[model samples]
Target chain A: MNAIGVDVGGTKIAAAVVSPEGEILNEVRYPTQAIPPNRLVRTIADTITEAKGDFEVGGACVAAPGFVSSAENKVIFAPNLHEIEDIRLDRELGSATGLRITVENDANAAAWGEFRFGAGREFDHQVFITLGTGVGGGVITHGVLLRGAQGAGGELGHVTIDPDGPRCGCGNHGCLEALASGTAIGRRAREVANERPRSALGRLAIDRQVLGEDVTRLASEGDEAALQVLDETGRWLGIGLAGFVNVFNPEVVAVGGGAARAGEFILEPARREVHLRARSPSRDLVRIKEATLGPASGVLGAAALARGEDGEYVLGPSKRVT
Target chain B: MNAIGVDVGGTKIAAAVVSPEGEILNEVRYPTQAIPPNRLVRTIADTITEAKGDFEVGGACVAAPGFVSSAENKVIFAPNLHEIEDIRLDRELGSATGLRITVENDANAAAWGEFRFGAGREFDHQVFITLGTGVGGGVITHGVLLRGAQGAGGELGHVTIDPDGPRCGCGNHGCLEALASGTAIGRRAREVANERPRSALGRLAIDRQVLGEDVTRLASEGDEAALQVLDETGRWLGIGLAGFVNVFNPEVVAVGGGAARAGEFILEPARREVHLRARSPSRDLVRIKEATLGPASGVLGAAALARGEDGEYVLGPSKRVT
Candidate 1:
């Protein structure tokens, strides 16, 4: 059955009409409105309706950021978006569009998207790590997503890599999030530029704020200071990857998110570290690959969820697709 | 059906006739012979025979340390034992004892035992960490042991906790095993005693070689030096536990193995660190419990494996228990 997959990011909402074969037939994009919760739901409903145009949408899935309640289908806590607490988008949007709806964590949706249609398609067990503004992950074991008891099982970024390193947003010290995220990369670049004014990053900083993109650009352009920053960040990323490799022993690890676009400047060191640290059998078997779906992964995964592609949902109450 | 369970340790071979409800009807133990591969198999087979007694044992499971093959019933690599590479214990023992046999990793067996009959009985998702001579673990996700693609998934102890702390047997530095195992604790005790010659542990070390039991005993008796060692070790254990808690978010974490017998001396600090480090929701829900099954966990887990209690096997070809 054809379904609508909506990706609700902090600034924009992207929706697409997805076919049974994981292909997007049509799409719509709108800047997310941070008005009253009900209005936000209505706007999302309108977007889904527009995206569904000329075809009857059987179901829809909204992938949002933060702590989504498995039991209530509500957004419990969102760190990035404003005033979305306790928003029952699934029920509201379902009633508005006269269709069934499922709301999921954005990262989980993206990982599922990768597992079902991207780099993880051939692997039974896979882990998708996204180094976006923060480090987030999703685990698929034996062809099923592991959602734990609560819906919070795949909080990979919060795992402490260092007990006394930098503080993380999750109120913990030395989390992978604090060391390897795009935000972390930008923060480190700013710090290095401020400390060493003669550095390559400092030269870029004189024109404007040095963002993660600038660091990647400078490193690619043969800037030693930028290369050092990427090398350090990549090492930490590899350490975190090694931990995941040892724990899950997954067949494939798909690395995505905006920062991963830095390419081999970051991933090469990560691959080397994972090779150096992970144990024999898993180290020999596991493959680390770049995620292929790009910005469409979340929408594709949301569509998959709408289609009940995960076989069965283990979290809270779930409605099965006919 | 009655089944025999054999624990193939480096020093000893323990076997038992187990009832369907996990009761040990009869048990036997023998010093493991380390001459030839056939002799070792014969010793294990003989132990199973002695343990079966008058009961008709339908099948048996041998839990040994090292890498068990996914496709073939063989021990691929055993670090603790001498010259057991590529040994097909399952076939030889099956023929010798005239019963079907299954070979599993000792840690996996113990985790199964805990999940089926011990502390993890109520929880569907459980992670068992055995703080033995070397740290090892098992993962039960949705009530099935996560035996990865190649049956090496639950190598939790090899996760890098400290990058520069100590060397692990797995050829990595600062792995959780290097920092929290019974062997690590004993090494710490000896190092402390030798470094601080006038301290309580130093005085004990003067009498003889410091052991993990000696540290526990001294700590229980109010020795400041011994207490400090346990406190530090427990902190590291808690750090590793926090990582597992965040990654898997299992309902219960059962701490087993001989080193965990230190009781409150080690557990209190571990509990405290886990409380301070783990993210909310998971931190509030996860229970860190001392495994009740103790030394018998390995044998009982092997019995569970023989009964095919994991619902389905993700590793290799499995024989269903009828």
Candidate 2:
């Protein structure tokens, strides 16, 4: 059997028909910005209906942003996707597509994707962290998603790491998201550029805004200032990872999102920090690596999370890949 | 069938035969300080045997302090109880008592106890934190104990709340334990006393050391310095609890151990801080409360964790309390 996964992201709405083995059979994308304001829900439904064209799909799930209530299958607070918030998604999409449709947090779906087929495929305990515009996280412990009482668990980005270090968009000080997200990386790049005006990163900042991508590019090209910015970001990331390692004791911590493209320049420093802070056995057993599925994780993970009408996983039990 | 639970602590070795309904049928205690060298194992076995007292016990579990490996049923490292470290407990204690005996981390056992019969009895997800000489924690999610890959999971105290605030016993700086434990409370009390020499805490510190208990006592007596110390401790505790609330989304966060005896003085400010720092839905849904079981939580939790020859919980699947 197959399932449809809808990634209702800020920039685009993508729906993919996926097989049990995590193979994508069909996919369609629509630019979210191009959708008329009142047509958001209709466009998403149409995209899913198109993606499911000829496939024998079991169910469908939409991976959206913000505070998602999994039980109610509703997006409570999606800052960018306000058009779809506060409505019972399963009912709306079910009526539209004639399929059992559900909603989930985008990061949680990505994490499930990683757990089902990516870096965490071999481990029962996995923590998936995404460093995009903000830090997002999902946790799988003992093979179950950790959705708290209101399905708002696994918000790893907002934890205080360096208590008084920096201010977070969440109105807290020193959150992991404040110091370690892609946004944080861009912010730190600018600060480093200002401090070392003679460096490549500083010179680039003089021309225009230095994004997280430019930092990775310049560091790969051996720019010392850019390398320092990434190293510092990795250190802060490690501080956050060390806590997760201690708490979840996951076997693999899959780091994804745009900033993770920094790769070893960021992960190596983060690993060093985990070794210094996390306890024995847990610190020794964990493997902190980049997420394998890339941008497609959202759709792939959502498909895996998709359930049949009888309330079972569309992919069934996860099997170990030799 | 009834099961026995042994609590091996720095101060005493106590064992109890507990019924399925969480009733203690028989109990025996031995002062650990009075045990002759190397007789620690013999004394512990004797305590369990004495506590059994002809009860129809199916199995027993020893709730020990240290890094307990649940897989091999071994105590890898016990800082305070070195005599029992690096030994297979199930085999040794099983042979000693002719019953299936297992080993578990003390705090994890306490959390289980709270989950089964105390503050968290009605909740499926609970985070139990003990603030003693140091901080210890255990978590239960979806009615299962969160023992990491090596039974070293649920180490909630080591998370960094204030990255540069203070040094921790684990050699990390600004861990939750470093800022919120009884030792941390005493340290803060001394600092506060020095800063306010006219207060009761300062006057008492001039004659003798002010313990966490003394601060509690003085605060209840309406002393300004003592109240300030507890308020500050609660705030740091809240900082750590806020992260747990976000990450675990537990229905209840139970505060236990000697430091928790301060009650509302330490808990009120912590609640205020949690309200300010934690995100909505999760923060709004969580209840931070004092643990009800007290010292008995150790033994009771161990009893609940006791596994039969079939490797099943002695209490069976949890049932809701009316």
Candidate 3:
């Protein structure tokens, strides 16, 4: 059945009318507003309605950032989006558009997208990691989403890498997110550039502000300092991946997000460290690869949720739709 | 249905006739042999026959140590038990005992036992950790065992904790098993006792070889060095538990095995460390408790497998019985 999928981000909201086989029939994007919660709900509803047009839709799903409650169909908390505490996205949007809607975490949605239509399509068990500003991931085991009892699982980024390392956004110390994320890479680059002015990264920092992308570019150019930074961050990613490999024993680990765009510079070192640290059986079989869906995963996963085919997290029909 | 359950360990084999509600009707134990594999199979079958006596049984299960092939109903590998590679336990035991049989991993069996009749009975999602010689665990998520694509998931103890610390038996360095297991605890205790000869643990070390149990006894008697040893090992366990909490987000983490008999000496310090390292939301909800089933978890879990009421790891019907 055809359904609409909405990806609600901090800066923008993207919606797509997805066919039964997961092809996007139509799409729309709108700038997200820092408005009251009710208005934001309307904005999401308006976007989904516009994307639907005259096509008969079976259902819809909105992929929202932060903790989406599988039980309540609400946004429990979104740190990036202020004043949206426990917003009932499914109920409000379903009422506004006169159609049922399912709500899921953005990372989970992306993972579902990959599992169903992208890199993880061939594997029944996979760990999908998105290394953007901060690390985010989703776990699919036996082709089912692992939403914890409180719908707060798959928080791979917050797992500790070093007990005595830097502080993390989750108020913990030395989370994988604090060491291996794009933000972490940029921070390390700036620190190294400031420490050694004679290095290529330092020269770039002196010439202008250096970012994670600039470090990747310099590393590709064979700059020792830039390459060192990538190696260090990649090693941390590998160390954390080893723990996940041991715990979940997934068939493949798909790396996505902005930092993953560094390509082999990050993955090569990660593969080395993973081989060095991970145990047998799992380490021997697991393949670490780049994610394939790119920007479309979140929306497509939401659409899959809308169709009630999104793994094991059952989203019952909305009473408001009736 | 009533079933016969067997637990095969490196040193001994234990068999029991279990009632429908998991009660032990009769039990027997036999020393495991290092002879040819076929002789060992007969020993297991004889013990089960003796345990069953006149009681009628529907099916039987043998929880073998090492990797169990859920599809083949065979022991893939048992490192401690030589020449048993790919031995079809179900075929031999079923034919000898005249009953259908299922084969399962020992750790998986223990976890199923806990999930069905022990500490995990109240929680649908639980992580069962047995801190014995090496740390062994099983994962039950959403009331189903999380058997990975290769039936090798839930290798929790092998997860890397200190990337540069001691080498593990699995050939990895600084795994949780290398840091927090009973063997690790004993090794640490012996090292400490040797270093500080004036302390209580040191005196015991000078008199005789120190064991993990000696450290526990001394710690209970208020020995500073022994207490410190327990605290150190317990803290490492806490650190690993934090990572598991973030990864699985299970409702409860039940700590079992021989070392767990130390009671609050290990648990109190572990609780403190877990609270310190674990992140919010999930950290607040998870409960770390001691396992309740003791040595019976293995046999009981095997019974669960024989009844075909265990988690998602599907065991095919016995060929001999058919």
Candidate 4:
């Protein structure tokens, strides 16, 4: 079977034709313009049209960066894309593309992709964390995605490591995202560099503003300040993961996103903390690994959603005509 | 239909004949001996026999401690009851009692009891926490119990709150149970008394050993030392609950434990911490309430398990009984 998966990001929209095994056959990308919801729907439809020229689309699924309600096609809330709030993406896209469309939270779609075709392929219960500009997470329990009562479950990044540490974008204090996210890492790196002018990171920051990658690069190069920041962030991430392990007792945890690219520098310490803190039996069974799908996970997972299959993106007959 | 519910605890076994609507028609109790697993099964059968004279018992369910298997009747591991490890509770009890039987973890049963007939009746997604010598928890998502891949998913107490604080029986450090359980609170009170002789708690402890209840009583009386211990424990509990809120995003959190008898003194602080820590959308929807089923929750929950109704302990019917 085949499917079309659309990944809606802040700046661009990418659509791809995916096989049942999650192989991408054809792809199309376009800049996401700051237009009304109706126009945005047309652009997404056009992208799907472009991808359909080479491969038959069975079903279409869209991964939106926000609270996508499963019971309805509406985007309840997308902080980065505020204008799309409550827009019926599924209905609009289905009308434009002339195919059935399903919408899901981007993180959940990515997690579904990983569970079916990436790092979590072998596990029945898994958690996928994407450590990008802000942290996002998806949970699959007993091989079923957990959408909660209001399609608002699996918000792992908001689990607090310190109740009094810092204010978070979600109006919480000391959330894991506020401490360990790529955005958090960069913010801390910049603040520390300014505070400690003699440090190596400070000298590097003289040329450009510090980014999450720069901090990871500096930590790898043996910068004490940078390493300390990464270590602290890893500890907090471990704390959060430990809590998840206790609650879900998942078989595996797949770490994705730009920050996870640091590999052991972040994952090693995080695993150590999880071992030191998580309960036995369940903790012993959990394995931490990097996500395998890379950037394509969202689209593939969304495609699975459209197909209504048990795993990452399901394809249907309607999409085949595309 | 009427069903038999048996709550197997460390000291006593409580059985009840429950109506479909959750009303108890009659009940019986027996002391639980440290006997072999088969004998324990026999004891459960005898209790059911005693209760059968009063009501039309259609099915029987036993709620045991430790990790229940996917089959519900099989006990994967019961560290507290070593002899029961790997025992097929349903088959043994059903054969002996001449009735259909089901088995489940005690916490899951209790949570189900609460969800179907007690405090959580109004919510589709709920979390139940029972605090005693240890912390036990159960999760219900969209009205279904989440018995992860191993049926050992809801180990809420095992989540880490302090990475370096204390060693838990589960071989992890700084677990919520190690820091917030009744045993942990009492232990801390004793340690404080020993270290600070002039403190009020120290004076109270000069006469004899301290109990969790005594510490709670002292804290309620404005004893500063006792208050600190409870406050600290409450904070840790809140931190763990915050993680739960993020993952489950349940509409209700029902707390039932000996420690919860402290009421608002403990619950208010825990709620404050969870509210300050969990993400916005989930935090706004969550309501923390004390468990309302009291001592009967276990047996009632177990009964719900037997009926194979909508609760945590979901069990399959025995072919022989049918």
Candidate 5:
């Protein structure tokens, strides 16, 4: 059996025709129209149609950025994608594509992808963290995704690192997302540049908006201020990861997202901190690794959901079109 | 059937005759002599002998303050009880008292007690933390203690809250135990008192041995320095709890131990921090409650273990007690 996976991001929609063994047979990509909810559903339908040309589609799964209510197949709240609030995305896309559709949060989808075919391949309990614009995570315990009581269990980024630090979008202070997230890193770099005008980072961003990439680039070039900023970000990441380690004690933690691309520069510090910070039993038992799917992780994860391997979508009411 | 429970602490050894329903029929207590390993086992046997006069003891469970090897039923490394390392306590006590004996880590016993008859009665998944001289915890998932691959699953107190704050016994810095445990609070209070010669806490600690009781006493009486110490401790507890919330997402967190007796002074701040710090899903789904058993919690938990209702200590060797 084959399935269609649609990854709905802020900029583009990517669709993949995936097999049971997690192999991708065919794929298609299209710009996600900056339009109304109905149009977005049409775009998803069109992308799925293009990807379904060479294989018989069993079911379609969409990985959306938001608080997805798996029970209702709706996007309850997506701060990054504000235009699709409360949209019955699965239903609308299913109606347009003439197939059954299952919708899930992107982070959950990525976790399933890792568990089934990537770094967490053989592990029954796993956690996946995506360190993109903000940190997002998904948890799997006993081979099942934990979607809490209200489909909001894996909000790992929101766990507080410092109570008096910067305010997060979730109305909290010193959250993992607010401390080590790409956005937070950029903000911190910009603040430091303004405070210390003599630093090289200050010279680079004289007029343009400072980004996390710029901070990483300067840190790589041996700027003490830039190195300090990355080190601080790594420390916060370690703090958040230590918390996750204590609670879940998962066998593996697969790290994805753009910030993680900095590799050992960020992860080495995080690993050291986690070892020093997490409870001994959990810290000693857990394995931390970079995500195998890279930028394609979310799409592969969404594909796994389409294949009915992802726990959330499988445990819910979604049907197969075969 | 009736059973005996022995709670072996650094200062005292408590034993109780417990019914199948987790009720204590008779209780006995004696000071724990800092003697040789064989003598310690003899003292435990003596306590069981004292309890057996009141009931027909079918089995006995002892909650020891260290790691107990499941394969050999031996005490591994009890730093607090250094004289008892590698001793086959269960076998020795069982032979001496003519009853089946089982040994478990004290924190695990407490968690089982809560799960069977205390605050965690209704939840299948729970995490119990006792904030005493050190932080100790036990995990129950699917009505079973989550003993890790190495029989060291729930060491919650050792999770780091601040990587740079203070040195911990486990050679780590800023552990939750080092920040919020009774020992940590007292140490912090003493440090502050030493720094400020005229502080109320300073005057109260004549010998500079600032115990947890003194800090709680002063904080309750509106002492500014003591309140600051408690508030800081609560914040660390909240941070660690928030991490647990994200990882385990247990239905309830039962807080026990000496420091917890401060009630709202400690619990309120921890609760507020959890609400402010944990992921929205965990905060909304999980309940944070103080231990209902109070000081007797350890003994009751130990009794529950003996009764085989706590699930950590079944009667036969085939069951591999958690």
Candidate 6:
């Protein structure tokens, strides 16, 4: 049976009707700016209803950004999309689309997407980390999603790598998110750019605000200043990842999201750090690589997570699906 | 049916015949200091044979310290015990004791003990940390022990908390083991003693080396310097635990071993740090408490891990057994 996966993000809403093989049968998208605050829920429901078309969909899952309570099927907090927070998304969407629905953290959905169809398709254990505006993560161990008590497990970005280094949005000091996220990259780029005023990154900073994309682009252009910034970001990312390698012992660490576009620039340093920090066998066995599905992973993963009226995964666990 | 468990440590060889309900039907112990290097394997077999008595034992497991390969059933590296490394303990001991044997990391076995019969008895998700000469840990998520690829997973103590703070035994800087272990407590106690020369801890340091237990004893006696050392130790421990809380999202983090004897002195501050660093719902729900099982956890947990001819837990997973 086909299932619908809706990715409700801060910028846009993406919905796709996906087959059990992870193929996108039909897809639809709407910019978040086009929908009114009160219309958000209805818009999401309409998007899913449209995406399914005549695919004989059994269920759907909405991947939202924030603290999601998977057991309750509700979003506890979504600083970016407050319209869905504290609401019974499953019930609301179920009534609107006539399909059973579940909500999940977008990162978790993306991770599952990679696990099922992309980088982690071959491994039983995986750690998927997305470096976007914020660092978000999801973990799978022993073929099951590691949703901890209350379904809040796998908050990987908030771990402290340097206790006194920097203040984070979560009100903690030196969280991995504060040091490795796109926001962190931009912040570090500015600092490095100022120190090296003759570099491409430094000249770009003088003209306008240097964003994470600018840093990646400048690094790709061989700017020493920007290279140093991304390199440091990779170092910080690896510091956090070394802990994961030691803790989860995953076979693949799929680095995704907007910043992962930096590719080997960030991954190379992270791998080196993991080699230095994580113990043998675990560190030696793990492969830190880029996530393959890109933005569509959200829909692919959410659809895979969708459960039917029979109460089993519509798409099934990938390990057993084949 | 009962199962045999062997705890081969640097100090002693403790073996037990444990019932399916976690009861010790028979037990025996021999000091490692008494055995010659060549006789170590034979002595372990003798201990298992002596401990079983009249019990109908199924399978057995040996909980050893250091890096273990559960799949290979061999100890790769054990700083404290070199005699057993790289040997086929299952084959060697099975031939002698006539029971199928498996090898596991000691900390992992203790964690399973705590999860099955101690503080984490009620929870499916648990993080068990032992604060001894060095910090070691094991995790249970979704009722399965997290042994990473090649079985080196759950090396919790080696996670780097501060990149440049202190060099660890694994050659990393600012590892949780370097900061929060009994060795770390002793090291910090010495440093604090020098800074507060008029305090009780300082006065004691003048007479001899201030050990981790001495700090705990002085703190219990209301010494400010000793209290500061434990409080600081707790703070560092909490920083590391906060990461575990976020990463594992466990219901309870059971703290065991020598330094945990300080109890609330270390726990209270560690809890405070977790509250400050960890996210909501997870931080709110987790209970960080002293592990109830003590030294017996090693033998008890290894016994529980013993597999039958059916390849199932001799005692079964606690959640299923009930």
Give every prediction's interface RMSD. 3.6, 3.3, 5.1, 5.1, 5.1, 2.6
Q: What is the lDDT of residue A17 in candidate 5?
A: 82
TM-score for candidate 4, please give it. Answer: 0.87
Per-residue lDDT of model 1, residues B132-213, tens digit only: 8899999887666777777777998998888787999888888999999999999999988887788789998889899999
- Give the residue spans of candidate 6 off by over 4 A: A320-322, B320-322
Q: Residues A229-255, candidate 3, lDDT per residue (tens digit)?
A: 999999999999988887777888999
lDDT of 2 by residue, A1-322 (tens): 8989899988999999999888999999999999988898999899999999988999999999888987889999998899999999899889999989988989889999999988888888999999999999998887777777777889999898876778999888889999999999999999999999999999999999999999999999999999999999999999999999999888999999999999999999999999989999799999999999999999999998898889887877653211
| lDDT for each candidate structure | 0.82, 0.91, 0.82, 0.80, 0.76, 0.91
- In terms of lDDT, the poorest run of 10 residues in model 6 chain A is A313-322
Give lDDT tens digits, candidate 3, residues B1-322: 5777789898888998887677898999988754455577778888999998998877788888777776578888887765456877677777888877787889988998888778887777788999999999998877767767666778889887777778998888888899888999999999998888888999998888888899999998999999989999988899888888877778889999999988788888888877887766778889898999999999988877784435222222211100
Q: After superposition, how far is residue B217 of candidate 3 from its true place, in Å?
A: 0.8
Tens-place lDDT per residue, model 4, B124-155, is 88889987898989988766677766677788
DockQ of candidate 6 compared with the true complex:
0.63
Global lDDT of model 3: 0.82
Residues A187-286, candidate 4: write the lDDT tens digits. 8888888887678899988989889999888888998878877887787888888878878878899999999887777887889888877766667889
TM-score for candidate 6, please give it. 0.96
TM-scores, each model vs. reference: 0.92, 0.96, 0.93, 0.87, 0.79, 0.96
B-chain TM-score for every candidate = 0.91, 0.97, 0.92, 0.91, 0.88, 0.97
Candidate 1 lDDT over A182-247, as tens digits, reads 999999998888877888898888889889999999998888889888998999998888988988
Residues B1-322 of candidate 5: C-alpha lDDT, one tens digit per residue:
7767788888898998877677889988888765555487787788889877957767777888766654456677776776667878766876898877777778888887787778887776677999887898987754556554344557787765665668987677777888889999989898878766577887876666888999989888988888888888887898888877765667889999999977778888888888877765568788888878765666666665653434344322211111
Q: Over 4 Å off in model 1, which ranges?
A: A34-37, A56-58, A80-84, A87-90, A194-196, A307-322, B34-37, B56-58, B80-84, B87-90, B194-196, B307-322
What residue runs in model 4 are displaced by over 4 Å at the alpha carbon? A33-38, A53-58, A187-207, A215-232, A307-313, A316-322, B33-38, B53-55, B166-171, B187-210, B215-233, B307-322
| DockQ rank order | 6, 2, 1, 3, 4, 5
